[model samples]
Target chain A: MMTDLPLDQVRTLLAVVDEGTFDAAAAALHVTPSAISQRVKALEQRTGRVLLLRTKPVRPTESGEVLVRLARQVARLEHDAQAELGLSGEGEPTRVSVAVNADSLATWFLQVLTRVPEEFRLCFELRREDEDHTAALLREGTVMAAVTSSPDPVPGCSVRSLGRMRYLAVAAPKFAARHLGGPVARTLTEVPVVVFDRRDDFQDGFVRGLTRGRAGASALRHYVPTSEGFVEAVAAGLGWGLVPEPQADPLLGDGRLVGIAPGRRVDVPLYWQQWKLDSPALVQVAETVTATAAEALRP
Target chain B: MMTDLPLDQVRTLLAVVDEGTFDAAAAALHVTPSAISQRVKALEQRTGRVLLLRTKPVRPTESGEVLVRLARQVARLEHDAQAELGLSGEGEPTRVSVAVNADSLATWFLQVLTRVPEEFRLCFELRREDEDHTAALLREGTVMAAVTSSPDPVPGCSVRSLGRMRYLAVAAPKFAARHLGGPVARTLTEVPVVVFDRRDDFQDGFVRGLTRGRAGASALRHYVPTSEGFVEAVAAGLGWGLVPEPQADPLLGDGRLVGIAPGRRVDVPLYWQQWKLDSPALVQVAETVTATAAEALRP
Candidate 1:
């Protein structure tokens, strides 16, 4: 059957994904739970695809995530557009769409905001995603720009190299002494490790690189997804894993965390990609990000 | 003052710049010209910058583009979100955003529409732009995806090989005879050529490659910006140009145009870049385009 998706219903899907359940989405949207359920069901029927994995807090199916991301991006653009057009309601704020990795979001990506030109009032709607996957957000038109690993330009976007982010394998001195049991490399696989999530693979990649692809990190993995928490867990001697240079540096200095591999480090190059439109705000952002990366990342 | 630019206003600003006038943008947006004017003024005040260089069809100042892009991206996400949410208006169809080069649009890009999944039931909002510059649309989130010349992926998107698009140096038999009276290398500089616009450098680049940077193509140029018109202009003996294989094929077969540089040809590599969204619709599109390109473009 011929069907068209309304803007508000899409926004509702985003609300459900973000809020985690129909009840919460209903409360957020100021609609009833029944309305939320019906809306989601309608979406599924229209696309003939299952959108949500109905669990405790409703998690979006892959299709649902596409829509969730789409919703957030729409809200953000609508806000920016309204402001550009000087159309604003007293209570409504402009939403800016940005794609950032979960690590950056939990770390210093927010600092990018502190640098925004304050004279031009703008609100931000941030999309937390894997940096490796953030560019997909741009392709789906989910965000205006993104922080990504690829140096190649996205369709219709210009690219600037941001530089590499270095990571070190470290753990608290006490924990290392207990779990690592002296020679670090020899016993790493035997010791338990902390992983950010099932998607976490840095530890495995590092081990593979070290062992020439013979092994992966310990299978006894503790899933701690938050950046701050992951760092803390490693600092608490939970497991040895990759940590950003800056975070590892202070801890190394204070003798809190000891590096298993002191000098050898892996550097993941980062790049800033944005649409080629000559938008004043995006340019300002690209400039700021470029400047920041110059200082914070490897040359 | 602390100002937040709304997404819709930013979008309207882009529409004005793209359409080249407030009234045209109004028509495109289904709003009155007064509303368009007011929106732009608000954006200017909020940014505390003169964003638009107001003229017959106003142009955005360097500052204005940032907001415009943000708006377009939001619109794209809105489209995607609406599709996922299945919110339909009585007859309004969901629009899909794509960034395509003028040459491709003039040739086979439209054919992609026939291959789309019938369930998508979408409208096409194709942005006419240069291939070299199409990636900018992805970065700005103006379109969900684009066909670009860069081999690299955009910041937050993935890249797939589409293959090289070959361009042949051809001229109308009359134009070639007049302009290329002597050895082409020696006389091409004085010969007039057809170009897309002021920024177009295809013919000049072709000349430079042949001449080892000693000289550029004709200083005298006839700007026939449209691809079909550009080819027609050349066939009508206006000047020589680098024509895409498809457009130049029929003309060459019929003897309307002749190749100037027999062995010298330019093969520009094209790629498909899109947001890394985990959506089936986008993935399907990318696959279809890649498969098509595999057959159509040079390996």
Candidate 2:
């Protein structure tokens, strides 16, 4: 059934989705608007499913996402084949897209890029998302690889454990004296808190774990989205938060930030997930990432 | 005509868009799916425009974005009014959503949070976006305020200058000695370069400004999405890039990075743009952001 899907029609569907409008897609493909419309209609008839929502900027349906993922994967394979055959233009580097979490990117992930061999001649397109959501990017075919917190692989993707990233509940010494002098768990539920983003529930999860699920972090919270900024916000006494060990270590040593929870820590196990393709670039990245994570993250 | 638009219907449209489906919206609002559908249909009929695309995860149309922004602004005003009248529940802090660029958030924006008076009792929902695209969040009603590079205001929003953020072309001393030995402009077009993200054209724009638009930064580029990571990558000899003055200053003072282009700097004038509502919380944040930018940015 998959073999029956027309490649040109599938490619056209991807182009329309990428360009957002039929007219825009026509301009991009150097085809007439009528031709673009006919191709899309033919593809829809072939699949017996409506693929795109014909809005100002067209959006894909769930069925459409499946095809889009296929189209991207096919394109990636074609690019790899071209590079291997020396058919790609001279000096045109192969681009590898990956979705990574803020913490890893800020800490050990950048080191991966520095470690890649110069012979690879690869250009990296990184999409920074929360660790919990990076797998979604992989499922959507928006990226070829991801550093995700989930151990389970997205369908058609293989996963490997990248070890755990430990976080400490920390606050400035002055903040501890001012607001957190009481029981640590009880005080955390009332004092101001710092979070990575609205989607971040780490601090709340920490508080809930400490208080037997009776409470969460404070209602008065500051959202500092960047990993570096989150650590800085906590150290500057804006609010208490769970800071990753590598980022928190320097501040802890300098007495700029102190551990509020004496022995409690959260360890988030990360995994490297990638499409089950045999592309050399993806293979190289996966190897470098796994090697780096082994050294940077706790076993 | 504007007053004729039903508030419930507008709010329903926002709910459907946020929840991404009629059933989800129904569950979120504690209403039946039929009621959610009827309300959304009514909104479209009243507005004489399709407000949503009925995809698996629904998307708002361009006209829908305008109404969503309106709904968010109205919600903001009502929250402020309730807080002022002391009708808000005990300890329910006002949440102010603001969109800001990464560089500002990392360098000086966190300071704004620390400076806000404790009595404001605010919970911040920050969306970190590129400065060039931050105003789009305002237009989509995703944020009440934004620190944007555009001086031109989004409709229904007022704008104020936040001064200029100057950037310096910097690379590690070792990177400079290796890849950047030739004339700065010509060499920059070919060397490995670092960028904040795909949307980031600052480095290329700097190169174009120097070379009279004949060239862009480099074909071989590494994307380090975080502002701190970007600077760190440059310092780690990954690539040359334009680093914000506040971030670059310390690195330069410490000799970790050297300026590649002497006397050539890019000054991006940032602006504070927010809805023209009389919300005290928004007003306070705007004032603090402006004050901090004044001290942290170049005139």
Q: Of the candidates shown, which would achieve the greatest TM-score relative to the real structure?
A: 2
| Clash list (residue pairs), candidate 2 | none
Tens-place lDDT digits, model 1, residues A127-242: 55676577666654557787777787766567878888888889888877777655556577666676766577889888877777888886545555445556766786656778
For model 2, residues A114-222, the per-residue Cα lDDT tens digits are: 8899788888888788765675567667788888888888877999999999999999999999998788989989999999887888899999999999999989898
Model 2 stretches with alpha carbons more than 4 Å out = A1-6, A21-67, A85-87, A131-133, B1-75, B85-87, B131-133
lDDT of each prediction vs. the true structure? 0.72, 0.88
Docking tier of model 2: it is: medium
lDDT of 1 by residue, B192-244 (tens): 67776757888888888888899898655655445665677678775688999
Clashes of each: 57, 0
Worst 10 residues of 1 chain A by lDDT: A88-97
lDDT of 2 by residue, B225-251 (tens): 888888888999988999999999999
Deviation (Å) of A161 in candidate 2: 0.8
